[model samples]
Target: MLEDVFRDQWGRVLATLVGILGDIELAEDAAQEAFALASERWPRDGEPDNPTAWLITTARNRAIDRLRRDRTLARKTEQMGRELRDRPEDTMDDTTKLPDERLELLFACCHPALALEAQVALTLRTLGGLSTDDVAAAFLVPFETMSKRLSRAKRKIRAAGIPFAVPPAHVLPERLDAVLAVIYLVFNQGWGAGRVDLATEAIRLGQVLATLMPDESEVLALLALMLLNDSRRHARMRDDEIVLLDDQDRSLWNEQQIADGRSLLERATALRGSGPYVLQAAIADLHIRQPRDWEQIALLYGELGRITRSPVVELNRAIAVGEIAGPDAALELLEALDLGDYRYFHSTRADVLRRLGRDDEARLAYGRALELTAAGPEQRFLAMRVAELLPPGDRE
Candidate 1:
């Protein structure tokens, strides 16, 4: 119970503290101290009636006390003290009128001035509530490296004097893409790690963004894409093994989520949103159909490829082309692309070769995929394919 509350409330409490204290490190320290206090007091006194409110009040008081004790913090304290005094503890409910500082924190983290990698790292750590270790693992970086990167990002934010507020409307479009990308990255990491909590948090944040910018078609489209993908979480794996999309039981898919996604897509289309996210969401919507329109999917991917000019999108388009035009054409398309090091590229090539009965090339491609991939389920599946390609008696 306590763990759930902490997971759900950590960002809200931390955001409130940062807003009040005007210092990230100080806010983090105070929040940690507040949680530690809760750990000690909650068991003895029973959990507070309004846990989030209690936590914010406790954390704010801690920050105020620290500021009072430290001579160096006196100026900041005085600056913030008036506003803090005006906002009473009783008004700290989850739905308090205090503008949700999380959106501000997110925008600040993804500011254009910061390096893109730093922006992603800061967003994941600060807004996603991921520990440095988890963030490092997600990005496949060493713990110490991730720690330094995070520290540097925070220092940059402080030194650069980046305001803790959302970007102006004229600049919102430019910055919003980075925020959306960070959220999706978080969701993808959680999906890969099988961390339901992280995935849930990402969805929650997406909903918040959508609510904050209702007319932003890409925001709605991104949320729709996530909901559509999340709807299949239950059927994506079985007994620790991957279940490919075509093989998954449709009955296991979340029908309501799919409906919601379709509705969002319709709204995006109504807004004349022809951006990459809306196109991608449109593709995902087609994939859920009983009889998928591969030609339409391929066309959408072509449109997306033109918009983004990304080789990855082209690769996806080739896959859809394979469905409509046959594996030979897909293999021809694959050979022209510069995706040698991409594991999925090799995996897709192997599938094409296997379908064409080119056992030797398929075996080599599968080996390359196995070597490149770090995912356990994918490695196991590829190994099984390799074993199948071996001679009858030579099979181990």
Candidate 2:
């Protein structure tokens, strides 16, 4: 019941109140008051026929009463009360009708006027339904700092009168990228399907977005991508240590998810509306579905390179090109890429050199990767990979 209440009604309750309160902070306070009231009375009332309606109505009345008693807000109180009363009572429905409101809140939180930090905080708070402390912990920041950022963001949204609506269709292409990022961020929280221990609030957020916009290609792509990546989670680690992709047992991957991912990729590309998430999904699909063939993978990565122009994509393309064209050709491509700042680039280059039997170059590349990586799991994995290539029984 708690999960359903939060998943279906929290955003709508917040949005409805925000519309009336004209203040995000006040709206949140009132909505929370409604939630508290539900906690106390729902068990006794045995769940109302329309729980959301009850919450919204109760919250609206609470906000009106509070404002009526505040001299400073008397005019705004009357105005907001009229607005709330005029809104249809039947606006509340089952969770099915609430995704659009949640998506609108996501966009409002990410409005350009908010600082990037505030945007992240507000996204987690309002859309992700996380506490400020949880958000702070996720980012490794102090809770007080996150609280301040969230407070400022909500205040700014009210003060600036940011429209709580989706961007115009003409601007959807650009805006969609931000939306996809937030969804992906949400998905990563509980994305490791096999590892129930890896759950996070991000997963709940992803489920909310998926429920809200199931037809959105980017949403599908993000969900597919996460499922595919997570499908390999068992193979990604062994005995509490990370395993490199090349060395992991492919048989352990979840075949069902791979199939779903493949189908989603086809749909993502069918309309030819290619975005970064779709392109990345295609890349992940290549890795999991067609392990034996890197030609198609290489070409896809090349296209992704043009689309995103991130150095990481170029490095990934080099890996595919190496598998298809030969190590020497891929080495030439890697030479032109100045991804010294990225550890994965060197690790990949090392693997390519090892495949080419260039021991000296491979050793140097491995050393470079080791020097650059901060992730302990990755560092240990690289060391093991590098050790395997050493002369048999060299006893290093």
- Tens digits of per-residue lDDT for model 1, 1-396: 777678677777788778877777778889888998998999899999878778888888877777666777557566676567666666776556554688888888888889878887887677667778877877778889999998998898889898899889898887898888877877776554433355666787788778778888999999899999999999998888989999998889999999998898888889999888999999999998869899999999999999999888889999999999999989998898898899989999999999999999999999999999887887999999999998899976
Per-candidate alpha-carbon RMSD to the true structure: 3.4, 3.4
Instruction: Tell me, by TM-score, which candidate is best.
Output: 2
Instruction: Name the lDDT value of residue 324 in candidate 2.
Output: 78
Q: Considering every candidate listed, which one attains the maximal lDDT?
A: 1
Residues 53-162 of candidate 2: C-alpha lDDT, one tens digit per residue: 67777887788777766777657567777776676755545534433366677777767777766776687777665666677777667778888878877778877888
Which TM-score value belongs to model 2?
0.87
Clashing pairs in 1: none
TM-scores vs. true structure, each candidate? 0.84, 0.87
